[model samples]
Target chain A: MTVLINSETRVVVQGITGREGSFHTKTMLNYGTKIVAGVTPGKGGSIVEGVPVYDSVKEALRRHPEIDTSIVFVPARYASEAVYEAIEAGLNLVVIITEGIPVHESMKFTRYAKLNNTVIVGPNCPGVISPGESKVGIMPGQVFSKGRVGIVSRSGTLTYEIAYAMTKAGIGQSTSIGIGGDPVLGTTFIDALEMFREDDGTDAVVLIGEIGGDMEERAARYIIEERYEKPVVAYIAGRTAPPGKRMGHAGAIISMGVGDAASKIKMLREAGVDVAELPSQIPGLLKKVLKK
Target chain B: MKLYEYEARNLFREQGIPVPEFRVVSTAEEALKAAEEIGGRLVVKAQVLVAGRGKAGGVKLAENPEEAYRYAKQMLGSEIKGELVKKVLISKAVDIDRELYLSIIVDRSIGAPVILSSPEGGVDIEELARSKPEKILKIFVDPVVGIREYHAREAARFLDLDEQTLKKAQQIVIDLYKVFEKYSCELAEINPLALTPEGSLVAIDAKIILDDNALYKYPEFSGEYVRDLSYYEAEAKKMNFSYVELDGNIGILCNGAGLTMATMDSVYILGGKPANFLDIGGGARADLVERAVSLLLKHPRTEVLFINILGGITRCDEVARGIVEAIKKTGVAKKMVVRLKGTNEEEGRRILEENGIYVLEEMDEAARKAVQLGGAI
Candidate 1:
């Protein structure tokens, strides 16, 4: 069984009338996700892909009360309000695919979600996809095949790249989660790693990290101390960022300190986790662990 | 998105938080006039968005109006953390009996705003975290309910303040929470909130980091351009491209995270530190690469240029045309080494060769030549 999502996970599409919402809704539906209802404030009662549309999250929830997860496609400006509404509606899991959302909005929403027991995947990410069960965000549907490797990352495109590389190397994924590219996000690497550890189907884990935050180091400590049965493979992006420049992702700031790639790789190596210097080397590293 | 002490205090004052009376001034005359009108000792702080400015000789305590002039004169044109000091905050100094630290920041894992307080103020919190972590009390506030009165009381009690001081501290915390929420700040901190000789609390220092991504709501965000760059350097920045003027001869360009990094490392391995790491990522257009080359050529250290294009989704010929265009525009007779591979490698190589720019097929050979030529720079 997939860890975060499955066939039983009824979903609602927030901002379903917008261009991105409409496009990804089609993708999710084609991938066999149950698209229960859609929410767009002004465009209620309209139908997209034969799915029901409602004005607010409450209205959509009223129509499809069984919906446990929400896939949001709202623009950056309105992402917080949309997320807040879904959380207040008691949706257990929310996947936000909108890029460029304000950090303060995510911080506030994340804080609110924590007080409540809602789990948010991203505000500037590709969202999570449990192959063969439910695909949430913008991951290419073709490259993924269901297997035992649990994948999590701070990058949008790199997740797709790693997943593709894994598939090409004859490795399939159990679940893939994009933690997003924001400096302050709802969940950390450890949080996702814990979930992977608990999931019985996940045989190993592939952690895709970037140059920012102490998250990779924190995850390394967890791996060292916990001594998980499954092997963990790590690949960090942004090794070429200038000494003091901030990259595209807000979390990719490597100013005076915090978020250097070499230091993160060193920590992972010391922790006994197999670390790949390049993205292409991940599959080979994972296979070596399997042989051992 | 960090604000200076004066700016944070201004925000706090607007929110009805108790702070020393202050005026932000640019000129020495303005600073002296403010100090004279206040009729007391003043603190002159350099206006720069950096921490530890007090230790950097940016903060000065002026005992008289004439001293204020001297301090402001010294600080106004100075540089702190790469930011020029264009302004100074002249504030009426408070009589300090004791000092405490307070802050509220977003805790990502918990998804809550944690209000942190400690009696040990006017020091770097990181140092405190490393040495005496137990002295700091953290209260995780529910964002839905916000910073409650009970939470404020708990923090005050933990700070070990007297009943009257606790009340004042409680009110300040409540006001600070409001300021944090309203300003869209990621972090709002007040260090050395001094208990005055008169037994009232005054925020002696404040720091507010406004969330940079949230600046879309603030129209002034885009218009504020600080540094001056040359024509090509400006154009590269305008297109959201990363360009660094470096002390080397080779101009290296590649795409993707792993590819670009490997290219740079290869250049270094071949006994040449790359002039710049340019990733003309997916869908690389000729114009973007042209601008990239133009920016690279502007560097005084560049005696030779190396253009490495690996076309995954980006066409190799596009990268070649950009190098050719840059050669035509700059008119500089700099030595160049070209490496093109992937999608349309043959066609891309033909474009470079037709334009009289010799193409080096191997990565190592390109690096060796570029480094050997650049060493003369």
Candidate 2:
């Protein structure tokens, strides 16, 4: 009943022999993510956490044809190639957890993924989690519980912070996705919103956006134009950030007076979305919207 | 990384795109010699990374070598848009029959490279796009297909080019796309693509911003460009930490970029200003966290240190150990508020508690405590 993944979603791990890849592979396994195979060039024929490792995605697919999803943990320089490999092998959904990927490479691969009818979650993101059933990302699994509220954000630990608060307040989540903090992302706020809209398990949505680019503005336009049915609660970070300064994320900059918190907040509020002033206020806002 | 105008000009010239003849000089005497050698009406331009250099009096037209020297003297070492002008470019001023605008930039909305052109050039493109949207011609180019001849021809037609100028302008557009692709630039622009009296198309100015993520492919650019970095900011860059200095009292440090920014925003919402935004990044060990904490403690404006760690990949215990080590090493004795949750939270809380640093479970509570302790309204 989850949006993108569930107990039946078999997975393959790309770059599973590396430090982050190996570490998170174990953690994802611990979260019951049904990881069927691992792919690492030259490190094939090995095993990581009782999962079979293949030299390439094609090889992994041949042995495990049930694997329909892939999670990439490759380094930035080679991450794009790994994504291309996953797409070429016909993986329906690829979740990229690598950070610092070149935007140009991401642009080409994301377009390629689209043409091939594949979905990409992030290049510099913390994957995805559907709570209780299965978790495909590197997020803290303990913070999330199965519920009807779907969470999508452009942040990592920040999503966890809010999700943890919601869980403590007896507000569980159906799925949570970090769409990444890069200037160019594979899955944007609009894309995630469409997915959440169609999911029967998700009764409400919480969008976590920050300053940078016009994605938030565009999402607001989409929400209004489509007359979105779900009661959406939102929280945008970096309200006090200065102009022309990158607030940690490469995409989180207020440039040329565009993509500031004030403008984003204004646009979202106009779209009839309840915007939280603080991260702690999100649970209360969701409760208000759910009540209505 | 944004390249200097002179550097962009050099790249354009290398790619066979025509640009005005120029010499980059740091001294006024060198500028005078270069101007005399060119022997025509020249433009003296201060080399800075900031926008609106012309409005800041950093760009001046000189009638003779003496005037060029005076302009260079006035511009060199002068501040423009808060950036010091360390070099001046003396170039021959062209007799322009018409001015045009052309650029290839990665459009985030389309998720592809886009070509933007306007017949009315040498003006603010953003302002123009806002006020007169119809004046700008946008052509989206697929990265897979690249800049086709038809795309260039379409741009040339949009600009109302003549029969002779059409071919030349189209070629220049295609060449500019090649440079953009080759260099992995976020933006490669020729602000005023001038058509001279001789019917020659020349790039009057060049602006290129290379993707920071793609810098690894171009190692020759290392340490060549000047970044507007403060002392602590530069230090953070060396350690591979994302840090931005702000004018506030509470020093904010956290794990992820969004979390760090959220921490800063939380402090702001509670009426506290953050001194700096520092993200130690994911999976940071104890030593790296110690270094980040020390960097914040050394800042003069940091009166209270707010450490918020929502551990996912980053371990809470490691962060707590680093904070404890930093305080002991620096001995600054500033007011501190620590929030540690997730991934060995009990151990991290115990370590902080043993060091007299009580930890809060909630981020808002921690931010409020730090703001109150710092006495920052």
Best by DockQ: 2
- Cα RMSD for predicted model 1: 4.9
Give the DockQ of candidate 2.
Answer: 0.83
Q: How many Å off is the CA of B341 in candidate 1?
A: 11
Candidate 1 contains a number of clashing pairs equal to 3
lDDT of candidate model 2 versus the reference? 0.91
Model no. 1, DockQ? 0.27
TM-score computed on alpha carbons, candidate 1: 0.81
True contacts kept of each: 0.26, 0.81
In the range A160-261, model 2's lDDT, one tens digit per residue, is 999999999999999999999998888999999999999989999999999988899999999999999999999999989999888888788887668899
- Per-model i-RMS: 4.4, 0.9
lDDT per residue for candidate 1 within B1-377, as digits (tens), equals: 66667778988999988998888999988988888887679889998876678889988888887898899999998897666899999888888988899999866445568899999887788788788999899999876677789998887777677888899999999999998898777788888789877779889999887776676565543344323343444565577664444445566666543345555555665677666655554556889888777767776666677776545446688888888898789876677888775557788889989989888765556667877876733
What's the C-alpha lDDT at position B10 in model 2?
A: 93
Model 1: docking quality category: acceptable
